[model samples]
Target: MSIAICIAAACLGAVLLLPACALARSATAAPASGIPATGVIGIEEGQLNADYWIRQQSKPDATILDPRAIAAQNKRLHELDASVHDIEHLPARLTRAQVREWIEAMSQPREETLYDERGEEIPAATLAALGDNLALDTIPAEQATRYGMVVRRADLRTFPTRLRVFNAKGDSDIDRFQESALFPGTPVAIVHASKDGKYWFVVSPLYAAWVEKDRIAEGAKAAIFDYTRKTPYLVVTGASARTVHTPEQPGVSDVQLEMGVRVPLLADWPSDKPVNGQHHYASHVIELPYRDDQGRLQFSPALLPRAADTSADYLPLTQANLVRQGFKFFGERYGWGHSYNTRDCSGFVSEIYRSFGVQLPRNTRDQAVSPAYNRIDLAEGLSHEERLKIVKTLEVGDLIYIPGHVMMVVGHEDGWPYVIHDTTGITFRDRTGELARVHLNGVSVTPLVPLLFNREQPTVDRITSIQRIRP
Candidate 1:
């Protein structure tokens, strides 16, 4: 069976970890009866494939934004969005109040009841303990910001502790602690340490959260920035790729590189020399960051196989490329805050656009309100018909937002728009106009019109905004 079929079958009855078997049936077999057996209610035969959407576009290959245009857009984002921090230009010193605000903003107590993995209610005292671990009292009056580089793909947590919490009991897919993830070679400004000294509150370009200290290596500011700006880098274009597994250099071995992660290439390396026991001939020698025993930054050459999905630079921002990139993550499990080595809905869209050098805020709330793009705001007063009219005009790569989730428009089929998104589940009106819920806890493609945000409202009516990554 194909990977999608396996994923779909394995995910049956799961609340938030995999796709439903209905997806498998839709991809593979037709019903024995004369009627077509599309397991998904609205998905048609060819709709599962990315090529179908690409074929529908009149100018699929046309560049929506060239590199120069993308660079301009990124510049505008930094200037407009408070969330998209310009860490490089950040001052070396920060006030205690500034650091406390950043910590309190992310460490606020949850409003909803939370449960542990064992189905036990997480008590108020436990939540208080987690808050105490923030070590806000230890912030110096005049804090010095330290620079570091992410040595590996590391999880960014809402709290310093690794305790996993969930919205519902026995549903272990979405861990509430996971805020986001930082890829290798990414620069961060280390500001505060957790009370236990195991995690650091570092601010990256797109996110600010508590990441494990060992995953970051302290280094000089110049060296860190220079490494980021190094020429002839490789941009991970696939959903994800890993370095060659090496027993010799355990730190750099088998490191996962997610889509849009750029690593500087060691172009001048000697071809005869081996990198971490592997010959350099069949691989691209790239510079990777690793934390030494003393927790300092060090760069070493590592071999990424030539066959790995990577580009010399960012892909051209075009309609076809957008559809293709979105499909690369077609069956990936939904990972909240970039957990599980996968991405959440906003992260999925962010990474897709990042592969083309487009910058986006890390979270759905921020991305929806960001002023960097051409946005069509659907106010609460707008009628469902009015929202549907806007949805019809949505082209490939347009982002549709409703509260905490976002979806990327792929194409339209018979005037009903389709979207590819990372979601836990979707409720929609089935053929009989009755509500049907499908637990699709993965990256999936589905039509837009029939989806419901809740029992009383359709997804279109809930749309807060639609952002187009164009001039």
Candidate 2:
């Protein structure tokens, strides 16, 4: 065994303990999954395939995420009043009564008073203006009877505009955010629109939010849903990739798509028809959407070079591939809720698994608590050493979840577990045994032991759950 895998035992025995609350559980329990199992360290690039999860989910009924669990969660969600940010597994078509319920939930002013960046309370007069501008009276419940599809990576903002807003001075976390992003080919029900008609309030299977009008295309109820399930599609496996540009159709040309976005290939496209003056066979001729002169969504064909970063199917869920896929975003700057033209912590992990056909909730809180994942409840009252021991057993793809953040276990070395995550900053001790801080405002790798949440609580102590997407 490599030094990394063998470091677990001696490492745990050496830690000096002082806290009483951390001693309730022992880390020595044989892992439920029999881990410390060898992972392929350097598989050839060509070998990344759907075979990754075959061994892990080998049991007859051992599936990926549990559908029965999701169905039950959806049933509970159905009872809650829907918000623009609430995730409800609603169908592609919502009945009129359902639409009215959604409208009522979204149209009213927020129950609590809102504050601006200056920490000044928003005056009641201003709140009234916001309410009036919401223009709830104009929501054409009769006209919004179809489905929609997002054709680009678009933000889901608190309000329907491109205006940038912040929480407070020195806090540029993009307060206009709604913890969700709609990627290409995501199906939605066209529920409502902004008064200005510039943004469409649509609902995905997991979330509902306002996406820019130009980024979405409304289609027939059946077509929008069918478009996503079509076979022979390619999933973007790289951080981001663009289609080969075609001057004749600039709208659909050079289109940019992020990781896990899937689009179907035009299987019947003839070889002789060249895109950008080259044989079409050399590229994956795929269908994409663009807005017509009438501002309605329409489909068009575009070319993505076969050599571009994509896959024939969702990558297999293997330890080696998990490491490989996680490294693809090694240096990307952390985007809060997909802000700063990049992805946030949850977005980073979500995209990695999406390339492998796994679906996850959009936020760390929900993901940590979701009943579908293979959850290792490390809630408080357990011994810290027991928690650290569980941390050591974490495999390459396991998600080590702290409140509001997540990290993927890439590997271990010298008794130190390394993680790659999208985070704003981290605190640790320097070689001189002095406290230090590093502003890692993007996706980065660091050891697990030295990390401190708020410079005091060991990250392990605050881990509410260690969620495994697949057993």
Candidate 3:
């Protein structure tokens, strides 16, 4: 049975259990648009793909995350990677003028307009204290840069504090300055620190933000960068995985590495060589970053058991494998800027493609309008039917861009396009024919046509573009 038909039939069964008056009212109710009432959409039987993903490893011909697919478009990918604000591609030395610029950009005190929990204005003294927390004058002058690596998944914050602030009370989410997150093993340049002597302002390949001092380890520039490009690395392809427990090396033991994180595999270690008394033969020897007693950067060896899910290399870049990889995060929570140990809309899609060695911008707007991809502009004065026509041809892994959001096309059912996206909310028609909004707050499946923008405007009427990463 079609998904819509199955859902309609299920609703019909619910009607059979309702009171007579409710049933009578339902008898004349306009049929639902066949969109699933809940955020979880069902996958059809034929959508299964364990075989393809499994075979791709043993049979190289079947792999999808092939860099060669876009090798000819290398220039485009380079441009996209360059667009990020990360320090990985920046110069090793900064002039005094540049240091001042970074300090000015990152260390300014906030304006005195603050609010209390009840949305009431806060006293001036409280605002001053908040400003005092930013020790801007402590910024250093010109210096040679030191390299660092994220030892753990760390929240990127606007300011150094763990405290959540808002323009008004009762608004706890977004945290105003929760920049993005830096996953484990992400390379960064240690540029500055907060005035309070707590947070480190480091720039990764994708973003620059204040991360907790304990979460990053500074190291030799050559050692840090070389470790990332070293051969025979294990790529963490799952949502997240950890090293096997090591009591001796608590600093690096069982550290969590998120999807697309790659760490070098210690090649050909003797069986007697062990990390924390565990024999190296049974596990992969991977180098992990950590901070020393004085809070400087250092590296250590840890063992990732053979059982932990990882790939010898990145998964190949192919549409079929995209669906399989994306589904691995099916129910992850929607975190803005990769907050709360979850990924938001753009972050979700980017991580999925990252497993296949693809790079994406940090936000929905950039990913949608990025010149690096094969984009179909919906703003070309096209009519409603014309836009729908373009949507019909959407392939698997195609990114559908509706303002403020992005969704990956898995496939279609009965001409209704289905999308897997990390989202906060979804809109669908209720049994009574009125639009209903459900807070998804996680990765979800939904049809593209019935989704409403702001629960009022049809997404179809306002779609800005449809982005396809593959040429």
Candidate 4:
């Protein structure tokens, strides 16, 4: 027998038992014997467990020849089941009385419908689009329905509960650590979830440590508008040279730029720079000047002002790409008299910056000493909170300095630091050489430094304080 027929028979039986009672109130505000009327009642059956049911009757059918009518009905039933599963999972400590009380406090279920393979008898909103076409041709539109299904599937995934790291060597368990040990900006991947309802993540290549899911967003696929996983860019002539839309590829091509590159930094551009200067072009390198709101390029572009708590325009600098390129340019000979024998520290900084439309001074001390840069002054010691607040405000291409040297922190991987700098006579000799003239030039940090000054690290006073001049 159909559900409607069974319900009708039961109602008739009840009415026969007490005609006066039926006349008094047909719609009761309490749970009727063997039937629930108040609050959301869950229907459990065949893979359909603990589904919430709203007080909605099925809408009248539209099309006659539609084939998916049964499928549509089944889909609606499924949705109802999903909604109640989690609600029932609430602590068992609550008694039936408390459950009743909690149910009373809940909101009513909003009515909805479901869809099937054929567009007919299906909810209109569930229709899928193929390319520019709505695919209405596949499913007859004549069968569309007004009512939609309200199923409780899953909500957005929450922060991962657990995190750990392992060595990149053979993807084994040689050197593993907890997520907390990772430095800011260090790259890591979310591993499996924990039994205690937590998430786990780790740095890749190195397989470093697992961290909370809150620290890492699921890569590219999870991104909404700009679904780019990894964006590669070059720091040419102290400005951002070219941004490749794709992730982590070596050797940036000019041909790609001619085709029109996506401006990932559009949200953070000159605003991140300290000073605002007119864009200029000289030689092969372009001297793109950072501009502030006042039309000057004298402040650090890293400190670009932004509205508090807005997610839009939260573009990121590609760290994996920088690491790959930084290593690629590793063994090239260092250039002194020549403009491009190899990259010096300042030359490297200049090249990377020029590529992005920002210009920096030629030397570290000059770049460090420039008054045009944004000033984030700190003495010797401060708490991590105080230091991080200032660092969080920094953007790409920002300068980080220690006693006598400087480096750029691009971004973070597993919350660890990555830096790029050129040291004297430490140019790339060649690829895969035991020992060439090439020695240890400093490494470039992504999203750069997390702390410039702190109360614990008094050594910071000895080093030239970092100035953010890019706008």
Best by lDDT: 1
RMSD of each: 5.1, 9.6, 7.2, 34.7
Order of candidate numbers by TM-score, starting with the best: 1, 3, 2, 4
lDDT of 3 by residue, 51-71 (tens): 332333333234433477656
Model 4 scores what on Cα lDDT?
A: 0.28
* TM-scores, one per candidate: 0.91, 0.76, 0.82, 0.26
For model 4, what is the alpha-carbon lDDT of residue 440? 29
Question: Alpha carbon lDDT of residue 365, candidate 3?
Answer: 70
What is the RMSD of candidate 1? 5.1
Q: Residue 415: error of model 3 in Å?
A: 2.3
107-174 per-residue lDDT for model 4 (tens digits): 12213332222322333332221111211123321221111110111111112211121222232221
Can you tell me which runs of candidate 1 are displaced by over 4 Å?
1-38
Task: Please write out the lDDT profile of model 1 over residues 78-180, one tens digit for every residue.
Answer: 9999998788988889999988888888888887889999989999999988889999999999977789999988999999988999888877777888899
Q: In candidate 3, which residue ranges exceed 4 Å CA deviation?
A: 1-65, 70-75, 80-82, 85-89, 96-132, 167-171
> Model 4, residue 339: displacement in angstroms?
9.2
Model 3: worst 10 consecutive residues (lDDT sum):
4-13
Residues 1-471 of candidate 2: C-alpha lDDT, one tens digit per residue: 111111110001111121221221222212342222111121223223323322333242223444454344444434442322332234444555666566555445555644566656657776565555555676554553567677777788755655444434444454543446777777777777777778777767667667788888777666666677787888899888888888877667778888888898788887778765657877898888776766666778888888889988777666666766787887787777787678888889988987777767777777777776678998689887787788877766788777677888766654556677786654443323333334456776656764444334666777789877664
Candidate number that wins on TM-score, 1 or 2: 1
Model 3 residue 349 distance off true place after TM-score fit, in angstroms: 0.9
For residue 274, model 4's alpha carbon misses the true position, in angstroms, by: 47
Clashing pairs in 2: 22-383, 22-384, 23-383, 334-442
Clash counts for all predictions: 0, 4, 8, 124
